[model samples]
Target: VGHLAVQIARARGAYVVATVSPGKLDFLRELGADEVIDYTKGDFTDKVRDIDLVLDPMGGDHAQRSLKVLRRGGVLVSLLDVGDNTRTQAGARDIRVERMSVVPDREGLVELARLIDANKLAVHVAKSFPLDQAGAAHAFLATKPIGKVVLSL
Candidate 1:
C-alpha cells in the first residue's frame, strides 16, 4: 500500500507526503510520515500543492483528481486504472504517467517472510473455526471481517 511506499521513500531520503483516512492519522504518524492529509477532511488537491510522485491504486475519479497535486516535473503511477485524456493533459510534457502493476516476486516474498519471522509484521486472524464449522465461518464472512478467518483442523 501507499503506507509502505512512503516508508520506503523516506528510507531512501526522499521527502514524502501521504494521504490516508482521518481515523488512520495516528497510524501514518507512527510510520514516520512527514505530512499526513486526511482525505475525508477536504479535497487533497486543494491543500497538497506541488508533489513529485503520486502512487495511486484506488482509481476512478480519485486517481484523476490526484493529478492536480502533481508538480510540473512529477510522476504518477497508477496500479488499477488506465491513463485517460484527462490524465494526459494534466501531465503535459514534464509529468509522466505510468500504468503499473505490482507482480508477485520471490525477493519481495522473501522480505515479507523475514518480517513475519522477526515479528515486525503482525497478521490479524479474526476467527479460526473447526473444519466442520466452515459453513458458519463463511456465513460470518458475509458480514465483512477485519482479518483472515481460518478453517482449522
Candidate 2:
C-alpha cells in the first residue's frame, strides 16, 4: 500500500518522502521516492516537517507524533487504529484526521486498473499461497513483508 501511495503521489507531482527501516531505503528510492529517511536511526517526526499528508500504518507512537510534521492544514490518516488522544490533537491542530476502512469502491478500482494498464502502477506479489493453506498465509504475513502476499485460489 505504501509503495502504491508513493507511486500515486509522485505521479501527481508530489515530492514523496518515505520513512523506512534501513534495509528498505534503497528499494524505496528505486521506486522514485524523492527522499528516504532511516526510521531506525531517529524519530521521523523530528526529522520530517511541513508535510502535506501522512499515511500511517503503525498508529500508536507514529499517529501521535506525526501531527508535529504537518504544515497547519496537513492531514494524517491512520489505517489501523484511532484513539481519542489522537482525535483531540487533530482538533487542536485544526487538521483533519481520518481513520480509513478500505472497502470496495467501483470508481477507485476502475482508476487503479487504468493506472495498472497505463504502466503507471505495479503490484508486487512478494509471495503466493494456496487457498487451502489459509493458516500458512497468516503465518507468512507474520513475517511482515513490505509487499503483498497473495492467495492464489
Candidate 3:
C-alpha cells in the first residue's frame, strides 16, 4: 500500500515524502518520492514538515508523529487505527484525521486499469508462488516483502 501510494501521489503531481527501511530508500526514490526517509535511523518528523497530506500505513505513534508534519487544514489518512489522542491533537491543530479501509468499487478499479494501460501506474510484485505453495506464500508475506506477493495458479 505504501509503495503504491507513493506512485499514485506522484502521478497526481504531489511532492511525496516516503518513509521506509534503509534498504528501500532507493526503491522509494525510483518510485518518484520527492524525499525518502529511513524510518529505522530516526524519526521522520525530524526531517519533514509543513506537508499537505500524510498517508500513513503504520498507525499508533507513527500516526501521532505524522500529525506534527501536516500543515493546518491538512489531512492525515491512516489505513489503521490512530488512537483517540491523535484525533484530539489533530482537532487542536485544525488538522483532519481520517481512518480509511478498502472498499471494492468497479469504477475505481476501471480507472486504475486505465492508468495502468496508459503506463501511468505500475504494480510492484516482489514474489510469486504456485498454488501448491500457498502456505509458503503466506509465510513469505509475513516477512514483509517490499512489494506484493502473488499466488499463481
Write the residue-wise lDDT of candidate 1 on 1-153 in tens digits: 665666566655777788887666776677668999998988889888789888887777777787888888788788876557747766574778777876889997887677667544445566899999999999988865545678988
Candidate 2 ranges beyond 4 A from true positions: none
Top model number, lDDT:
3
Off by over 4 Å in 3: none
Flag regions of model 1 displaced more than 4 Å: 91-93, 105-153
Q: For each candidate, C-alpha RMSD in Å?
A: 4.1, 1.5, 1.3
Query: Which one wins by TM-score: 1 or 2?
Result: 2
TM-score for each prediction? 0.69, 0.91, 0.93
Q: Deviation in angstroms for 141 in model 1? A: 8.8
Task: State the lDDT of candidate 2 residue by residue for 1-153, as single tens digits.
Answer: 888888878777889999988777887888789999998998887887899988888898778888888878789888978678987887888878988788889998988888788787887777899999889989999987767888887
How many clashing residue pairs are found in candidate 1?
0
What are the lDDT scores of the predictions, listed in order? 0.75, 0.85, 0.90
RMSD of candidate 2 to the truth, in angstroms, is 1.5
Clash count per candidate = 0, 0, 0
Best by TM-score: 3
Cα lDDT tens digits for candidate 3, 25-114: 898898899999898988889898899999988899989999989999999999999999999999999999998987879998987888
